[model samples]
Target: MVGSLDWTAAGGAGDLLAPPVAAAVGAVADARAAEIDPGLADTAAFCEHYGVPMEASANCVVVAAKRGGETTYAACMVLATDRADVNGVVRKHLGARKVSFAPMDDATSRTGMEYGGITPVGLPAGWPILVDEAVAAAPEVVIGSGLRRSKLLVPGKALAALPGAQVIALAQR
Candidate 1:
């Protein structure tokens, strides 16, 4: 029964979304969500089963990079058709020695969302959100609503305007 929720009234499911994400979506004029099975949550399967276009779906990845013996984190969003240039662009942008996907546990716990459903909307305020230019150029895209059982439909501009979010050419191909 998660059909078309305004982020403000998302109910118990709101706990799965980061506090800022929950509030921010409500303020985004075009944000909305629809229910789906948690089992079909990952991008490919969800897209195939629900008939969502791969080009219009964005995947949010949590990355951790090491710089001067410290681990810094960022949430990167790229179109499902492209890959995040983590080792090259991300590491350089973060000024870190190396970068990799965040450990599953760290990502899930830190974002307060399921492993496959972490999104950029409400990531920790300090964790930068890098949205690939391709994704930011789309009119609208489907992203995780912070729960495995739902998906959020939002305008690309809304994502680009998220706190600490930057629109960059973040894709590898």
Candidate 2:
């Protein structure tokens, strides 16, 4: 709270993060979670309303693909300034016949998180978390808190280290 963003006043990261996500972030030395208004959940709106820079924001997307009759899911992290290379980088990295953004219902139901508030920290086991190289180099990045009511601020390197996470060139200008 002293050096960081008053984490205590922001409430315990435990309460703000999803159960699995809270455990993961709790282990990271530089991660901070803060409560936010749910109405301002989208990246642009939240950044503008909270006076945070767009460059400081990152988006986590859930991608789905089918390989040999089995459906697989992956979580991708990219800077707000760029889009995830779903059909190109992601599709190839995932090694699937087809790749696309997962349906909203599938994403929420499987991740146990809100539609627009999914984070790479607590994704289902076996699902790869693809992090854009640029995001992994950021000093600090704002990501979803698993719920629409809060946000997580973490060092980019920490995010790139999550289990099954792969730091790659996933962003497209």
Candidate 3:
């Protein structure tokens, strides 16, 4: 019911998701999935072509927070209309001296997800998932499926309740 795309139970779309995402879809009881043109995976193209409102889509960004000589990777979820406050709220919350978007290779390889389709779900254990308060307050939100060819739909509360997830004021707008 998100866009013009046909949605089906997430469990039946394993082929459209990365292994980790496919395995974790069961955690969200109302999770649904829809296939889309892989070439349109980027947020702007996907939303425009599929008729999904920008506000209804959430983007998951991978970040690297460094302190001393150690680096910690975390995922940040924010609505498409907002930007994650990586250098401000996120850095302080992560207790890192510096915070930036993770390198593309590191983000994709570590999470076992595609660069453009990373999602908070199925992330490696122990990694913090910072979800913007606006994202968690949405009635329903669309997010990545860990595969460029598909997207996942879930209730906002389920995302906030994911293991290691912490809802906070993480969006700049």
Candidate 4:
């Protein structure tokens, strides 16, 4: 019976990771899987569910700003220990008077990604992806997998390679 067991079938049955996320992670060298059942509505909930040591995980958020009557997107990657200083750094970087976290519905709709699953990798081209330097320093960091139920463990170098990601010191103490 053990020899006859289908590992793929068994693994697929309870997979919390989405296919796209899995594929993206798989494409990167030195990336590993860290599946979690995070019934995450937001970063805090995600951290809580997975018991991710704050020192090792990153919180990825999408901020929206209206610049010259045009809506712009900013992908902020901050360490779990600190919050993205959206109004301070993000607004200044985007050159917008008004900047805020995009509504969940808007984020999901625009990115075509689920809440708690959005990552800088494989996002639409031309979006500004700002990664906190702290996150980049970690040997391995956990990030959302483009789906809520699972997270992906990727090396910092792999994340920096994602399109348009600028490693910046933007996290608030």
- TM-scores for all candidates? 0.89, 0.92, 0.99, 0.81
Query: Can you list the residue pairs that collide in candidate 3?
Result: none
Residues 1-173, candidate 3: write the lDDT tens digits. Answer: 88899999998889988999988888987999999999999999999999999999999999999999999999999999999999999999999999999999999999999989999989999999999999999999999999999999999999999999999999998
lDDT of 2 by residue, 33-122 (tens): 787889998989888888778778899999998789989999999999999999989989989989989999999999988977899977
Q: Report the lDDT tens digits of candidate 1 across residue range 1-103.
A: 1222333333344554545567666655567676778899999998888888889889999999998889989999999889999998898888889899999
- Give the candidate order by descending TM-score: 3, 2, 1, 4
Best by lDDT: 3
Q: Which whole-number lDDT from 0 to 100 does residue 65 have in model 4?
A: 93
Q: What lDDT score belongs to each candidate, Candidate 1 first?
A: 0.81, 0.84, 0.95, 0.71
Residue pairs whose backbone atoms clash in candidate 4: 117-146, 117-147
10 residues in a row with least lDDT, candidate 4: 1-10
Ranking by lDDT: 3, 2, 1, 4
Point out the worst 10-residue segment of candidate 2 by lDDT.
Answer: 1-10
Candidate 3 TM-score, true structure as reference: 0.99
Q: Where in model 3 is the C-alpha error above 4 Å?
A: none
lDDT (Cα, tens digit) per residue for candidate 4, span 1-173 = 11111212212323545555554445555655444555663656655655667667787899999987899887999887899999898898889989999999988777767887887765667889898888877787777767765666677767777778888888998
